[model samples]
Target: MKKTISREALKSASLEYNDVSGDFNWIKKRRGPIKVGQKAGSINHAGYVVIKIDQMKFMAHVLVWFLKTGEWPTLDIDHINGIKTDNRFQNLRHVTRSVNLQNQRKAHPNNHTGLIGVNKKGPKRFLALIQIDGIQKSVGTFENAIDAHNAYIEAKRKGHPGNTL
Candidate 1:
């Protein structure tokens, strides 16, 4: 496990927090003093904000978790709104991997049906399915994608934690 930094140490390091954006600003001595409320951290390849401290990289959301709760999160830090860059405290939560996947975007770029968990079984029919405990369970087959998606949604609501819809 990675070593966790304490809130006191983080504060003493001259890292200022913006409650509104849930970001941390590092006061670099060479860059001169930064303006108050200025946002810091760089967007990583995965779209998450990363801050470097003492040569160690920390995710901004995870840092926010530690700053707010005074302890490291035991589970995954999920962006509740599904926007990876939106690190607002109100839009973040600690949830299991399964729960995090449940709240993902409705569809991926490769999805041809334009709906999650729904696939075309025939020219006019669609099949709805969901994964529970790593097992795929079929919800049912329907004439339209909407019906199939509804069934998938119903199954997700029943089996997936933190499901909003």
Candidate 2:
């Protein structure tokens, strides 16, 4: 609800949002580097689209929610399909922190396995684990990394099959 740009101001400023394509565009020329009809926003470090106006920056998803609903949201926005830059209205949802974490598609920074939820338990053993209801629980150990990964996926499926690392 804070730092809100009114819908009218948004239309006069950023111009339009293509709901189907999830793309925003400038309708009129601006004073600086932006040109009319140019695409708005750029991918930030964490892979989300960011838009800047009047020296203030906004997350495109947040803006989309605000523009679509005419009210700012107070909860985390989860990209249902796990694609950070896909801002399609249908692909976004408001969820609690735990639900948002459930849909996370990236491995933790400390996770060394190329596959998420699997880790090397020892020199030759691979361990599979998953987070359920916010608690991390072990699935099983395997001699092959792929098996460990599969075990993790199966464990994850038992919880929420729509999302996997």
RMSD of 1: 2.6
lDDT of 2: 0.82
**Every candidate's CA RMSD:** 2.6, 2.1
Per-prediction tally of clashes: 0, 0
lDDT of 1: 0.82
Residues 1-165, candidate 2: write the lDDT tens digits. 468777787767745899898888888787789888898989999899999877778899988888888877888887888888888999888877766777766678888887788899898999998878668899999998889988887788788644534
Each model's TM-score, in the order given? 0.83, 0.88
Which candidate has the highest TM-score of all?
A: 2
In terms of TM-score, how similar is model 2 to the real structure? Answer: 0.88
Candidate 1 weakest ten by summed lDDT? 28-37
Each model's C-alpha lDDT? 0.82, 0.82
Tens-place lDDT digits, model 1, residues 1-165 = 876787777777668777887777665442545554456778999899987776688898998888888879999899987888788888889888778778866687777899998998999999998888889999999999999998998899898868656
Residue 29 displacement in candidate 1 (angstroms): 5.0
